[model samples]
Target chain A: MTTDDLIARLTGELKPVPRTAVLRRVAIGLGSSLAASATLMYFWLGMRPDLMTAMETTPFWAKFVYTLSLAIAGAWALKRIAHPLGSIRINLALMGALIVAIGILGFMQLAMAPPEAHYYLLTGHSVSICTLNIVVLSLPLLAGAFWILSGLAPTRLTVAGAAAGLASGAIASLVYSFHCTESGMPFIAIWYTLGVLVPGLIGAIAGRYVLRW
Target chain B: MNPVEARLKELMLASLDGDAKSYGVLLNDLARHLRFYFMRRLADAHKGDADDLVQETLMALHTRRATYEVDRPFTAWLHAIARYKLIDHFRRNRIRATVPLDDAQELFAQDQSDAAADRMDVERLLQSVPAKSRDLIYRTKIEGQSIAEVAQSTGLSEASVKVGVHRGIKAIAAKLKGGADDDR
Candidate 1:
């Protein structure tokens, strides 16, 4: 058949697509995943035994603010990176700034404290499992993000996957804060950032396979 | 930057809003463009097969339209789909002697295979050429720059730029063939 004839036959019985369907679907998926992760945190991990006392400390609030900021920035970056040709330079730069801020906080704490306290501050109580917990908690959020990508058209699969991973990791850390007893700025900054980045690295490697249409 | 591309972009945006008329119009325009695109690449003996490629490409575009990034130029996305169809067509014809065309058809019935990998391999192959020649080849072939423009940018005579690009492409093709042979 001629091209004109084909076009007519194909588009003749078209269904109207909802506007912003991609955005809406992904947003809904992420929201549900976040709720599920929060529930998991509450039950599986349980709120820290000293929740009331911990909240009273400046370090506790600082850690919460850091994770929350990372989560929000990561989520926004994920949405923007969904576009294949869309630039992620700004998003990456914002992440760099957040890391720098954490570094400054760590430096200030080091200068104010004595040498004997440095090691303890750096290790806190959960150095061994801190990063691992972040990755484990991120599983549900990563699955949901992948599901959303499957429904939409993401051109740069590896980058998009990494962005999703970064967002998921940040959300996982935010949830982990409720259960984690670590109070050192140095420990939170170092371990929490690594925890968030591990999934992003994994996503970059696996994105080509999983996110490909 | 072309008017046709701008118009196509507008239609695509409109179609996303549930405008069937705009969608139909965009597809019609694409079909017309694709006919010429495929015809130019196919040999005289296989020219008639361009319509099949066109049909396949159109179906792919329709199915994968949801993945289109709104801010991207529509032509770039359309061209990527077209390039995949062309490569598949060429690969099938090349191995037609041993691979029964019908059997091959069954294997490739789903056209959602990863074209990015192939494109990336081609890019990696291009990197084997030296920097100056590689830049020239990229500008002329991938970026669609005129030989005169490339020469001007690199401060070379148009003749030298043309020769460099031609040799660079030849080198890449030879290396790629060698790699394929090793794989086999």
Candidate 2:
């Protein structure tokens, strides 16, 4: 009816909302989706057989750090963009630095290795299916992030979508790492990054249509 | 931040704590500001839509209150939501160009013929709704009467009055959509 009447109704029904409501929702969305992704990974692609041995290796830890850092950056960006007028520049910068650092590490590894091993480092054993798996695993996480975003205020739909996509991709990569035996920095820099980007691209496009209030 | 922003932020913080009175005051202040904000961007011919937009934005602010971060500048968050609602309104109306606030004077200079025509069309559409619901919608929406007032006058419960007004609006909207589809 009238603005005054609407305001009256709104105030009348007002309840004390928890200060951490948004954070809680984000956590729930991420936690459940992560569990779902992990479950899917365990069923579809069992963990690496040399689980005890891989834990003590440098390359394995490198892959873990790279994916984990990216996931954190994506999450930071997503949280920021979930608010109205929230800026993602810092988050983007952090993510960019992480990628460059990984790239540098991969380059050094390639350079030190013999030229004949260059192809092996880059392609690893699963180049054909690595990116595909990451993309597929990201679907559940992407859905969860979108669900969380739909309930919040995000002014820049495309950007917010991209953040959600990036976060989902990174987190998916982390989950996929458990099953992946490839320890090459070059493989992770090339294929893992692509897997993350594919979902980010999908998120940007789908967000424009789905993230509307 | 300005004193106004500080005060609004304080009120919002209180409102989040379930202080209804403070919340009401905050909403009233916001409504005044939003009226001026929407009135400026809208063309003169479509000024009647300004209040509708204001109402829509207020509703969004209410539903998405949890998204407001306590540490962030309150005005920036409010402005973003307001601008988003305005953009959505423009897109729905297929309004490609907007009158800048600087040229708001030009808005008053334009004729009201289009608005008058729109009112007539709305009156025609209102006829399709049932008489009881139509009366409720008219009293509450056009007359700007409170739901409680309407309910008391009509001997109907407030909930029923609310439902009647809601149904009436939905019926009119459905008819308008049908008309647009026929034109297409």
DockQ of each: 0.25, 0.59
CA shift of A54, model 1, Å: 2.9
Interface root-mean-square deviation, each candidate: 3.0, 0.7
Name the weakest run of 10 consecutive residues (lDDT summed) in model 1 chain A: A80-89
- Tens digits of per-residue lDDT for model 2 on B101-137? 3322232233345567888987988899999999999
| Tens digits of lDDT, candidate 1, A110-202 | 889999999988998889999998898898898888887766556566788888898899999999998999988889879999988998888
For model 2, what is the error of residue A4's alpha carbon versus the real structure, in angstroms, after optimal superposition?
2.3
Chain A of candidate 1: what's the TM-score? 0.91
Evaluate residue B128 in candidate 2 and report its C-alpha lDDT on the 0 to 100 scale: 96
Give, for candidate 1 chain B, the lowest lDDT window spanning 10 residues: B103-112
- The residue-level lDDT of candidate 2 at A72 comes to 92
